[model samples]
Target chain A: MRKNDMRPDELLKMDRRLVLSATGGMAAVMLPVVLTSFIVSETARVVAAVLVYAAAIIMAWAFVKRYVGILNAQHRESEKKHLSEIAMLVQPITTHLNNRALIIPVLTNQLNEVTKQTESAALDIGEKFMSIVQRARNQAKKASGAFGRFAGNGGSSSESLTDLSKKALSDVIESLRDMVGVTSQTLKNMEVIIEDAGNIKRIVTEIEYIAEQTNLLALNAAIEAAHAGEQGRGFAIVADEVRKLSDRSNAAADDIRKLISRVETDIKGIYSKTEKSITESSARSLEAETVVNDTLRKIDDVIGEVKKQLDELGAETESLAKDISSIVISMQFQDITRQRIEHVIEPLMSFKAELEDITQKARSMSEKIHEWEGNSSAEWLEKMYTMESEREVLKEVLKNG
Target chain B: MGKTVLIVDDSASMRQLVSFALRDAGYDVIDAINGKDAMSKLNGTKIEMVITDLNMPEMDGIEFIKQVRNNPGYKFTPIVMLTTESQESKKQEGKQAGASGWIVKPFTPEQLIDIVKKFAR
Candidate 1:
């Protein structure tokens, strides 16, 4: 109803109900008397019957009219009360829906923002993890390659080193054997020379003895020559020739003895020097073999150490690769979590949509209530009255009144 | 050349995880960002097995599996779905698409390797 539309404030306002009761009582008293008068006066019966029917019809019409007014007034009051109650219910519902609608979008936006940020962060972490894993894998590959190369080269070098050591030992032994052969040959030659020198000394000594004998014979001949003066002169010349030959033989034997002594001394010095050289060469050959063996052993040790270090490096790289891989695996939690969050957000999005729908419904309901408020009581009753049976009851009461 | 395994996932982290695990187990791993990318990478490669995610940007795992089954080269190749989805309907779809198995997310590397070994080798 319009806000300015008001009920009457008069203390004595006669409603349709009072008019109906008064008219109903009058009809109740007059109807019976008029019927009895028609029985008593037969000649006037038609006129009295017409007057009674006319009075009854007029009272019934007034009663129906007043009762209809009562019914309309009650209907308007009930409609207004119902509309007021509906407004009271719709206001809070609209408010709640509005608040929820506002809050839901904000929540959805925040969720979206958070989801975006989480996704970005997860991507960042994944990229970093991939980088680390890639670097680690590359390093492991390089280390493995290095280790393989080192092992390969170490094997070949070790073989080469062993061959070299064997060759060096063989050369040393061969050189020692050559020195022994040369030294022995030199000694044998010196021995042969010494034997020949001895033989020469023996021959010279024999010559000297011959020369001594000749000298003795020459002396005897000279004595005999003194006894037979002139005849002995020819024999004395022969004896003197023999004495000169003997002296020359003795001088040559002395020269041969001196030469044999110096030759023997020189041969002894050469033999001593050759013996010393052979001894030193044998010792040096042994020392050289030992040195070569030591060097080979050192090379072997170095190769073994290098191999061990390479193996260790390979192992470390493998371990590092494993660790980086594990870290990458751990970082996968972000993707899983992101998917989980998206799953949760799916329902949340549905809920938001439902809330929006509810908010829209509430808004429409509120608008309907506001439109209802503009309606007059009669209009509301005409539009909202659904009880045909109640109208029939109201008509009967109206006719009885 | 070792046994080759193809890993398909939109998530880089998941791909890296699978790649690292497979590579560590002495298998050659080929990873792709999605099913479409996996298909592109699958060309001319001797792939023994495939591990793919169900949800992806271009082509999904089921469709990818179906495509792989359609291809003459990969018709008999064992394809497995790696995903967070455990729904029976999705699994049935994968199976219908010629998938060999399903492995859920957050799975252990050993679990993956064991499954790969079972099929790839």
Candidate 2:
């Protein structure tokens, strides 16, 4: 393995192996040289050989120790370089994770605030709408009540318009009948007056007849006075005066009879005209009564229609109020939606917390790369199952698997 | 005077929704955030009924119902559990804790009012 990739303990074991192999090879070579010198049987030569071997063995040991130290120094340098590279790579990721962790909570909080405000505003609008609907219902009820009072329905004490109109027409018809009765009575009186005039005419005729008879008697007396001559001369003079008086009486009687006839004719004409007028007035009065009754019937029909329409209006307003109330009830869905949103936000918060934990671990790992060992699979798996759905899925998978 | 009901839930929206439904149904309503808050609000005010959610912070519905049953004044008051939990075991737990009725979440206003009328009456 590359020195930087190798663990410090593995590098230490390799260094120990290299030092043992060098010492064993140097000992093999020195032992043989010392054996050969001892076999040569020369003391001075043997001593010099031993001295050279000792110096050579010391020099070899020193060289192996220095080489092991250089290898260890290189391994330390490589380890430092690897740790620096890991820190460089982890810095940006840690920062990104930290930033996301910080932002998620704020974002979720803002979302929660917005949701609350929207819910409140929507609830307020619903309340106001309900208030308006209630007010409208009350107003409609008031209007209907007033109309009922005007129509005299529902035990109102005041007379209805229909009743008032009928009553007024009835009074007019009664007055017309009264007038017809009076006119008929006046016509009957006129007839009676005409009959009395006829009686007076007959009386005048009798008077005329008496006056004629008296004149004749006066004429006879004058004739008798003439037949007795000279002694009857005074009586004849008186008789002549009586005869003149009788002639004037006859002329006045004739004038009186003619005046009575003219008076009877005028009375008959007045009676005929008044009787015709009374008949025509009675007919007109009946026709007017019929017309008034028809008008009253029409007024009743119109008022009945108006009252029906008002009742329908009241019913429709009540139905509308009920519909608005149902709408207000339907507004409760907002609460359900809000609960669902809360469910969603809970997992998001878990994810944010998990991310923050990972970032902290990453920072610690970067600082101690040489000593760092990554998290376990189970630890990561535990974090992955933050939501209930995810945990359910995992359960399903385990059951199936 | 209308009967009073208390609603307890961690969700504000849910509390408001229950409050609105109860108030519209001609009953007075009081609301609390959780079981602990609900416990504090039960100060001998003659609450006829209680509606509570299953899960909450600090204290939960089961424990809350137990506490309520311990109170002498509210021992007979009807307590209904309103929750998203549909598990039979959880329901049994709630029943054992003295819940009078159980209602799943997303309930209609009519259903809630009907339940209230039945139990509160």
Candidate 3:
């Protein structure tokens, strides 16, 4: 497959096939089979000529053999190219396979180590951090709940207060309406009272006129009675009394008209102020409604924000919960890892444990290590420990004996 | 003394989740939405631990980690890759990028707390 192992000009060998086929052409010309048929046919002499011609044909065939040298050289070069191409294709694959074989075990060990560490860490974390997470979640829940309660309380109360304000404003407006209605009635009643006052004034005027007429008549009668001298004196005195009564009646009617006029003036003043107050109260109620609407909108916005926060908090707590479950699964791995590692290192660990303290404790170390490191089935270690324990027991028995 | 941890994840829920576990283990929590946000927070804040998601919309976790380690402030800070990946190549890449360690995702609240305590503390 080396490059130089093959000669150059490998493709030129295709011409050798053409050269070898060209040799068949000479058979036609040299054999002259048709010519033989035209001439005297055949015998040893003709056969000798044929043999000589065949010899020439054989000798000329050397040219064809020479062409194979080029062909072989070309073949060799192509074989080399093919071999190199194949090598190019295979090299990386082989390298990869080998690399994988080498890396798998080592990587698996490292991964296992990582798995073990993560597990133990998880257990330690689960035992330690679970409470913390739970506590945090609990606290968060509590805080959110408190905030929610506070939000609900504050929002509702504010809403209530605004509502109450609105209601009070409405009540005031309604009361004002009633007041206006009553005032309007009072104004109408005042108009009627004013008309009555005018009627009283007209009646008083009539009474005055009647009184003047009656007084005039009574005077006439008194004058007439004077003319008749003594006989008429009694009649004239009676007429004078009648005139005095009419004057007293006129004075009383005048006093009643003055009282009515005073009342009408007071009513007119009150009606003017009441109309103005009604207009002001209506404006105030409208202003109050606008303020309530604005406040309500603000409170609604705050509630919306709080609700969004609460939703976020809820999702976070749920995520925290999921994390806890994964951690627990990791703890299971931790337990298995602990046993696996303990078994792998039991002898070493036991030796360490021994150096620390191994009197009565040494007796249980085998079983303890066995139970702890279940994956490590070092039966020989177990046998060795059993022999030691048995020997110790025998010594004790002998001493007691 | 508790560790200060900064969680950088696009999801608000995820950040809250990590914050809960970390804060519970006596760690103070800081948060960022993505790598750019984390970088900004880091520049403005003091944090020794950062838990970040690998895949994010703007500035993924890997690039962020690389940038963080390159910066003077976070040369030795523990940057734990919190992800749902188990690919060795990705881990190798993370290692190459100067990740301190990795924690697989969908982790239990307890496990996350444990891991944060282990690395952060």
Candidate 4:
């Protein structure tokens, strides 16, 4: 009989009655009646011996049988206890196995896919960074070359700084575009997974519904098999088997439900990740755009300021020209005063000449640096840096002036 | 060009997975269900590498490795033990039984391929 089919109360009832019956009336008859019949005679001695022996044997057999039966009952009780323990452990074990069995495959597939995605992402980021570095390196080389030129002959410095800023801005924008591409592609893939998971959830729920129907059908079959009584013994076993399988299948469906829920959760997680990645990419793009705009604004502002300074220098230069013209024209009539003015004017003109050369070199170096930034041309970059250092010297001369 | 390898494990699914990865990495592969069956396949095959499980029935992997080592057909074959168990005695036994290397189970494709490439023909 099936363990579940047996009732504990009924078992206890039968066990108690069995132990009591053997020691009761059977013991009463076997113990006394035969001993009382024993008499003193040769034939009677044999007959009495036989009767007493028979009583003892019967009583002994009954006692031993009861003891063994009780022993068996105890053993059965222990076995039942063991079964319960096993049953309790069964859920976790089955659940664990079921989870592992599904999870291994699901995660394996996800890991493979995600690894591919992340590797590509990392590669993309590395490539972007390298490109940015290359741009910066080229720009630095140009500035160095301008400095080398400028050091050889003093030149302007403001233009070179502006060129470097523009190149940095454009390069950053390019890398930002690549990052955006990767982020969008990843988001698209994640969306597809989310849709697929949703579809799978729907299918799993349908399957669960069908399993519930199957369980009900199996129950009806079991009831029908029961009504058949003796004729349905084989049918009942078959029905029971079907019912067991259905219950197991139902349990399997529940596992799938849980798995589907987990998958949906994981998909949502991935979606969130994709969203976060996109958000980060967008934010980076925005930051890059802002940097570029700010750089442009700084360049324009510096150009405007430099132009204003150059205009002031021009006005000063015009006044120096007027003073020289006046001194040359009136020098004979006012030689002493004119000579003194000439002494001061000569140095001022020398200063103006030096300033003009410095400013011209600075502009040349800036152009070379800008060219290198655009074409990544090392030759131009080398020239630009040489000019930058010259620009630095000129700025010092102007400061002294 | 890459190493030619044979993977012997009882699980069909695991075989499919490992082979998929190894093949993806450009390795030639042969497959078998278990140790006994692996031996039978090994007789006429020229597999340069063998990655086998430890706890298979009917001629377990260790015994198969021993027999393979004894046979002239595979004396120099590099045999790696792949299994889930981590008992020290089991590892020692595998090493004494002539295993070339040992790796725990649930390794990634990269890890598997990384190890395989180290001895792959």
* C-alpha lDDT of all candidate models, in order: 0.76, 0.78, 0.66, 0.65
Q: Is candidate 1 or candidate 4 better by lDDT?
A: 1
- Per-residue alpha-carbon lDDT of candidate 3 for residues A334-371, written as tens digits (9 for 90 to 100): 43454455455545444444433433343344345434
Q: Model 2, which residues run further than 4 Å from truth?
A: A1-26, A29-86, A154-158, A174-292, A368-401, B1-48, B53-67, B84-93
What global local distance difference test value does model 1 have? Answer: 0.76
Model 2, range A51-102, lDDT digits (tens) per residue? 7677767766766665555565555556566666878888999999999899
lDDT of 4 by residue, A24-138 (tens): 6576566555565555566776666667767677877766676666555555555555555555555455455444544444544554465445445443443444354445546
Backbone clashes counted, model 4 = 31
Alpha-carbon deviation at B21 in model 4, angstroms: 86
Q: Per-residue CA lDDT of candidate 4, range B1-121, in tens?
A: 4667999876444455566556656788889888889888888787879998876668788898888889887888888998765788888888888889887765655577778878775
Q: How many residue pairs clash in each candidate at the backbone level?
A: 0, 0, 10, 31
* DockQ preference between candidates 1 and 2, better one: 1
State in Å the error of residue B26, model 2. Answer: 4.7
Could you tell me the lDDT of residue B90 within candidate 4? 86
Question: Interface RMSD values for the candidates, listed in order?
Answer: 2.6, 2.2, 10.3, 45.3
Clashes of 3: 10
- How many residue pairs in model 2 have overlapping backbones? 0
Model 4 Cα RMSD, 1 decimal:
72.2
TM-score of chain B of 3: 0.92
By lDDT, the candidates rank as 2, 1, 3, 4
- Report the TM-score of candidate 3, chain A only: 0.43
CAPRI band of model 4? incorrect
